[model samples]
Target: MHPENTNFIYVNREMRTLSNIDYDITLLDWLRTNLKLKGTKEGCAEGDCGACSVLVHDGSNSEVRPINSCLVRVGQVVGKGVITVEGIGNEKKPHPLQTSFIKENASQCGYCTPGFIISGISLLNSNKDVDENSINDSVSGNLCRCTGYSPIVKALKSVGNNHEEIKPIQFVEQNNDVQLGLVSYHNPINLDELLNLTNKPNFRYLAGGTDLNLQRPIINEDQNTIINLSNIKELKNIEVQNNKLLLGSAVTIENFLVTIKDRIPELIELLQRFGSPQIRNQGTIGGNLCTSSPIGDIAPVFLALNAKLNIFGSNGRKKVNLNEFYTGYRKNILTKDEIVSSIEVPLPKKDYNLFCWKLSKRYDQDISTISLTVYIKIRDQIIDDIHLAAGGIAETPKYLDNLCKDMKGQKLDKSISLAINNIKNYIKPISDIRGTADYRIESFRGLFRRLEKCLVDGVKTMSIMDYNNE
Candidate 1:
């Protein structure tokens, strides 16, 4: 599939290839060993740490964004463009943030400087105005054992007013398919070609590598075949029809946030804590749902919205209700040959008000202890209709139909108290690294308390600081 000169990537705007390398090699390894660019360090191979952060252009029409090089395989970027720390700037002609870092004493251990610089420069080059919040979010994936992050924030602020133009990057022609070692990677540009390939057996769909790549058994193992869904334009569409919002499976979470900013301003705060900027830029909503993780953040909101999933396969296309999609822990109703094509979210009516909240140990880049979404319509100060859904409180994302039924026709305060007292009836969560089963129950109840206070008392900061006081 090299096609004489095509099975290579434009690394740092320079063509680079490893014709004999295996597909199991990570981009971090390839950058350090094969290409001999050791600037991009690898701290956490699981993509938690940003030591391996790099800017990547997917060879699509979009510009470059940050992602973890450790979680990405070389085969996945055959025709894309990658820019390591070295590509951004150097000591002689350093980026503005680089110089400011030294002046602010942002480099003590220096293990994370390159990654921080890379992430900071990406923010500086974007159309967004630089601020403390933006700078903090941009480098949230990075970890510094020293410097305490104070100098880092100050350094980034020093260059916040400066914006520079990045040189154009080049992309190599994409190989339709390639087989290396135990991994067979396929890049299909359209829906028909994708379906034709998945009609066979033992194939896995890859939208974003954020989740799958962390689990080594899921990628390049047991001679597995990967059908990459990112290149298909049909799976990346966003549309509105008949008072419903249609979101394609391959659309990144960052793009989803941008699209819904004006329409659903309520979700903006909850999603800002979705993940680090790198993850939000690469992880997709369909990928989030497909994993069936009990704590996956996006599914609860969809469940509350009465969303429907659009499925396409050899049998043709069909729509399935989101609440009925999950069967059990890490399980769904989709057949092996079928994949989620898109998600349809019904737009709220004039009388309906939606509220969503995520409870995590840390506010950003953390897994939820419990996630809650409440959609309510009030008529004459009585709750006419309400829908409640939550994550991390059960084996699957639980839709609280019984509780919704119980709370209807009740006042807001009465409804909240009744539901908070009855949450344990609907969920039986397991103890895990994030929290205990008992703690999760209380957290979800606390979210209901928060809903009551915010709506009735005009609480500030969403009452996050006074959580236990309730």
Candidate 2:
């Protein structure tokens, strides 16, 4: 351990010094190339494949969570603890899960076993139930081409929940800027410090970094200054206030799902389809909105709920509705100096009937071709109020205020299909690689047609994919 150099991380329970590391250098590359720890394989570098998964224990949370090492930068884990496959065990003193994998023949071709083991370790570290569904869900992000995943699930089940526990460590605050050779990695402790650093040229706010890191340039490609917002306490909270759920911009998508699962259980399906386990663990709710992707999964549901965004800048804080936040494709109303602090979603009334869906080619880890959310308030079996929002059917995630209003006071019958046709005038979708414009339009209309079957007939087939032992 280098006491003189305060820049180091706990790699496998040992402090390793970091010196002159490249800015664009990912933790995967550093582990495989620099440290010679090639156990963490690289499959799809964009974080879809969990071959590069690892367990990281940061200062923000006491629990060790699984993250895609390919998407994590070197500076992000400064002073944190990282546990790779080597950290788990060896051939002589194999960990319980590793031994179980061998006994049950869970690993084939031996490529994705390390990541699955790491994910299993993370699952056991937590207090989750050791059952068939939980075991399947824990490794949903990991893929095994040779082994049909039944063996993997069996291995985890055989071992049960008694995992080799990771020793707890004290967390010290490291909120200052990190200076590499050609990169300036800024870590602002508070909102004011974050706003002041916004003046730096070529600046970008790093929230979950699930998107930005994928599109960032390579090492020494340009002198870029990136700021990490995960350290700010004001932007990482989850609380309920005055009948509204206030979700901080920095709250992970997984955390959001856990917090609102009981309150708004209807949204659980859509958020579960949002991404795999690793993607959900790293991507934040704010990053999903700020990206303003036309195919984003978070926007449609929030729009149907009429969420409000709290923005802050040097001038002061301001509130803007979600409908007015996006101006065009991937463009939002935020200025260079402003940052979204949190999202305010009003709790619905008891009569609220919410429906959310995302149409995609695959059941998991695929982009949305058409995402829809329809919220209806029922009064005496008639449609008292209605709100609809959709994505991938326009230049931006659109709110069908006028079209949904046309269905107000109408019975929840097939006659409402006439009003649903008006969505053609509101949306301006174009053809692309995902689907053609006509396909999107027709499919968009089909969601409403199915909506009737859902609300009236009580169908449970909307995005229905679960980790059940069928």
Candidate 3:
């Protein structure tokens, strides 16, 4: 038996002081089975389905965003406030979004209703202006088989247009004390504690657990230790100094978007297509980079940005260029005790043009079949400095070093053709479920052709997928 403590977590203005709870179970299971809150349905155990969506206040920020409970572990919510579907409305009086759903006849089978309502509430809470795309993006993760999304979208518009002041139902107590769990769950307050904990053997560093949760069940091992890096002040810092932005590894993509919204419109457009709102709320830059997936949305962008990483370990700290970060497919040079602390992104010059594209089957919540990033400076139609990077076309996110060097001082049109030819020889993509190798190669050629057309003919910009007939 494990010993108990008075560590508390808030849910819907009511505080639940938990003791000796099982730390291994997911937040969805704990809510549905342990707490008997069955309103939040479960369609898919994975994060793809928004059926398990709930609003969580991280206790540090005033904004409350929706998150999938299926991907969240019970211990991850310590000192956080969670609001489920049950807390949104009562039998006597339903919430505004719930009432709109009823009035708009949005529910046919009603399995995905609660999730839609919760997500819609979050959308309204976060944004004062509502549009069709905004509503669709808000509930993109939710799927309804019986009823189409038209009525649901209409219902969201009705409730989301009202400018209402949104606040968390319960404010979690800000306790700086570390949470020691029955299992080896540790939340280090500072870098020293994190380094000390990492010095021990067989410990996994967990950031947001978006991708780690998917791997935990498959890689079933008796793993007892996880170092939570979300709460460390140093790891969550974002600074702008000397014409560059220094972003802590633990900063969520959502926070990063808000920070660089005005400064980097192109980057905002790219990240908006990264994942669903819920996943972006929880997913961090460090987690994305650490996974090192070939088709990861941010890898090519980081490569194009010429980013640098500040890595920490038991020994000390060291800096590494992002281009040399990945050694192989889904592998990096980090030791077991090393953790990425922060990232340095240089601001692009006014004369430079940065372009990013991702080709996938679905418009939302889909993995990329091919991702490309280009940073080029054109002076009087001659390419000056060109940096090209691509993913899903190599073992890792590859920087086209040879192609970039060859393109320098060449005419812009000739440089594009040269890069296209260089791709045929350099990139050897494998056949995957998302696409065929031949298909990827052809798509990239077409992408380059479109880029050339845009620069030469001054055509309006759209995704490469848009230009393709097939």
Error of 2 at 275 (Å): 1.3
Query: In model 1, which runs have C-alpha deviations exceeding 4 angstroms?
Result: 1-5, 60-62, 171-175, 217-221, 458-470
Candidate 3 Cα misplacement greater than 4 A, ranges: 1-5, 163-166, 170-182, 218-223, 457-461, 464-470
lDDT of 3 at 278: 84
lDDT of 2 by residue, 1-470 (tens): 34643877777877777765755688898888878899999999888779999988875456888899998888787778888999889988999899999999998799999999988988888888989867777787888899888888888988887777765454553555676657788887778788778778988788888898888765666787878988788888999998889999999998998998778888877887787778888899999999999988999989999999999887899999999999998999998878899999987767777888888887677899999888887665578899999899877998888777778887777336665667577677899999999898888777777777666665433554421221
Whole-model lDDT, candidate 1?
0.83
State residue 323's C-alpha deviation in candidate 1, in Å: 0.8
Model 1, span 261-363: residue lDDT tens = 8777777777778888788887998999999998888999999999999998888999999999999999999988788999999887766778878888887
Residue 410, candidate 1: C-alpha displacement in angstroms: 0.8
Clash pairs (backbone) in predicted model 1: none
Estimate, for each residue in 1-470, the C-alpha lDDT of model 3 and write its tens digit: 11244455677757776554544777788788778899888888888888999989866566788989999887777777888988888778778788888899999888888888888888888754689878877888787888789999888887766735457754535433333333466788789878777665577888899999877752234656777888788988999988788999999988888878766666866787788788888899999999989888888988988999999987799999999899888999998888889999887777777788888898788899998888877778998888889989988998888878888899988888886876777688999999999999998987788778766754434555455642
Model 2 bad stretches (over 4 Å): 1-5, 171-173, 419-423, 458-470
Candidate 2, position 232, lDDT? 82
